[model samples]
Target: MGREFIEIFEEWALDYDKSVMGEHPQYVDVFANYDAILNQVVQQSLGTVLEFGVGTGNLSNKLLNAGHNVIGIEPSEAMRNIASRKLPSMTILDGDFINYPYISVQIETIASTYAFHHLSDIEKEIAIKKFASVLPRKGRIVFGDTMFKTEADKQLEIEKALDKGFTDLADDLNREYYPTLDIMKNAFEKHHFDVSFKQMNDFVWVITADKK
Candidate 1:
């Protein structure tokens, strides 16, 4: 469902890690507390994990280090190749949030970071329903992404970006499908997930949604 952004990620594969490392000026805040963010997600995750958008395998590496069985899903071939080379033993396949290969092992938790916004609100709901179908009761989804608490907060952030002469960042803010907290809460609740959100940085939040 989010395949339209695959080309952008494929082209950004080589530079993606650099950007996440706080080298990219516009994205420094976005990746702020990057290691901590991954750790938070990893800490909350349980058993086997299915990770979406394994860009450069940063979060995947963390999940692996935490001793969970990690099955990575990525839509960008270039990104997948990079992750494969980095973590040769992990099962990384070409896939996205709404579409992935069938796994023989049970998935206890679905995890992702900075990538869920690739889906629009409707697509997010669809994806949540798909995850509900895939998961048993008490199975969880731990995700971290850029989301605003309200529409006004989102607009204010966009204006602040523009005011700071961050045209590219503003463009990205407008371009990406970053959802408000209410929208995400509704999506998860509609599918019977007991969801909660925690701020990770100026721009990111960690979501722990346990299936009910």
Candidate 2:
């Protein structure tokens, strides 16, 4: 399943930026807000920062422009290829977040966008624990993704898409999970992180957690 998803996303990566990255004004606004939120949460100049699922280095470029050393972990080779071509200075690693190899270098801040929802419940929990284990005492995590109001609502969207016969290449991509806000907050709390949430849109939520 994972391999299939990666293959689909790898193909999507070919035109992801031109097709989806800047196509939505709302998404751009949300990213701007998220960047401000991250600046405020870190409370000091950022040092070493790690971004999981840093597809195409869009946000990674923004972080670098803000004067931080950025390391990116991406699962899709196609995405990494785009990122490398776009931002050669970034240290990009190819691996899933659940099993990415990292050195003992302590990360002061971490951020992810539009990626956490792809993780399974157990995978999310383990990933949160792994992040906590490597972060310093005051480290922070900024995560945001598409969120559903309810299972019924999500089903309705799926049904609508299917009815429209919207058989895009993305339809072939495997999305293993879509966690509720409660589930995400609880998972972070379980790892000793103070959590807060903000609504970015009707279908998206931004969460920031700080290590306690």
**C-alpha lDDT values of all predictions:** 0.92, 0.71
Candidate 2 achieves a global lDDT of 0.71
By TM-score, how accurate is candidate 1? 0.98
Error of 2 at 78 (Å): 1.3
**Candidate closest to the true structure, highest TM-score:** 1
RMSD each, Å? 0.8, 3.9
What tens-digit string does per-residue lDDT give for candidate 2 at 1-212? 13436876787797667544345342343244554444443333257888888888777887787888888889999899899999987889977667787656768888877677777878889989998988889888887676666677656655555565644412522244777777888899999999887776555576878899
- Pairs with backbone N, CA or C atoms under 3 Å apart (clashes), candidate 2: none
Can you write out model 1's per-residue Cα lDDT over 1-212, one digit (the tens) per residue? 78998888888999998998989888888899999999999999999999998989999998998899999999999999999999999999888999889978899999999999989999999999999998888999999999999989888988988898888889989998999999999999999999999999988999999999
Q: Where does candidate 1 stray beyond 4 Å?
A: none
Error of 1 at 31 (Å): 0.9
